[model samples]
Target: MVVVVGKEEVVVVNFGNSKAVLCRGGLAVPLSSDLKGERADEKGRCDDEAVVGRTINWNACHLPPLSTTSRSLGGEYRKQYIIMEPEVTVMKRTEQSDDFLIIATNSLWNVVGDKTACEVVKRYCVNGESGRLMSSDGSSTAAAASEAATALAVLAMAKGSRHNISIIVVQLK
Candidate 1:
């Protein structure tokens, strides 16, 4: 989940391949990790299972069959075979950076990208000012955030997110 601790800081404790990002001026900077199986093995941080960077796709290509158990629970997977801890990123909001933030699951990212998502969200942050931006409606931050979130959800749906999409857009005011 995403937690806004203070005016200029957010702590994102993300898990299960979900992701987070900080956006500024139509660009998105990722703040979370995928925590997939092959990735973990490559870093030698876990059970280095990759044999010359090549392993069977069944249990190697995916997220180590640990994040989810429907495929196989208490099966061949050992504790050392996967990393289940969430990747936490603490972002200290800078007045000059990150106009907003988007926290979403992998479903959305599987179809969209950083810049594209930022652009989609920027559609609602349309204050003009040559992209300097202001709230969507000059009323309240919540309105802007809601509109941006809706826009993102709609766009992700349109882009065909297969899994359930969970998204939150926060205006970094």
Candidate 2:
């Protein structure tokens, strides 16, 4: 997650199973949260073999259950196990040449890792393109990032990925 707050814009990105709150003036302002478990699989089931008696290794690195509302919204009946606390990156420019960019994704980390994502962002930055922009208010930065991530996912899909893909992108100026 990268958050950039420049003289002209503010950007934010979310990619983990945790919640991220970007507050203003010391107030708690939630920038992004895994309220819907959108990153989780729709058909993935909890690994029953992972459970030892009644204790389950919920922290296991394995894929979570499709119905598991461990970290999402609209699961009032189930206990909140986790929150979408996104890894945040903030860049605030004090000069007039301030700009913001963000990218996000939900595909397998093995396909397009964070280093690749950062490289993509850097490439976009050096390429000098204007269409790929981040949000100014920092509200849509994640969305912008998601778009970039989606594009990467599509590329990965072309390469071959037998799974669903979702991404968000946001840019500000």
Candidate 3:
């Protein structure tokens, strides 16, 4: 889910059980919302011992297992619950000099902290432009960041594990 407020707009891409939201207002207005029912099952209580072992993490988190949702739009899961792990980008656009960009993915967010993400964006910003004066097309930022994250993920996958990804880009101008 991606929301852009004010005169400016934003672009978002959501993959799998993950979501990205872009908003202009400081108030928490979600541009996109994805709630997966499977979260509840992981919160529920199960009886079978074998099932219990598999569902233990759900109990720890006070959520049910995510296997309840059977079908997904991209055929990523069968009978699996949908989880909305959201990536939110809030850009406060102003007349003086306000431009910003955000790109995110589960893997990137998981490995690289928010500070690192901010630093990456800062590094990409043009030298002369004010920090706030960023690109208007949030999509381009998202695309660039996603590409970087995807490259990283591919390298990680080559090492062994795979990761799901999503990105959000914002410009404050």
**Which one wins on TM-score?**
1
Best lDDT goes to which candidate?
A: 1
Off by more than 4 A, model 1: 38-60, 63-81, 128-139
When sorted by TM-score, best at the front, the candidate numbers are 1, 3, 2
- TM-scores of the models, in the order given: 0.69, 0.41, 0.43
The digit string of per-residue lDDT tens for model 1 on 1-173 reads: 54555676778776444677788645788877655444643334433445222234563354343342111123344344444455678877776666777888777776788788888777666564444334555766677677777777777888876567888877774
lDDT of 2 by residue, 105-130 (tens): 33433355544544554333323344
Error of 1 at 154 (Å): 2.4
For all candidates in order, the CA lDDT equals 0.62, 0.40, 0.40
- For model 3, the local distance difference test gives 0.40
Residue 103, model 2: Cα distance from true site in angstroms? 3.8
lDDT of 3 by residue, 15-90 (tens): 3244343222222233333333333432342323343323333412211344422113433432233233444444
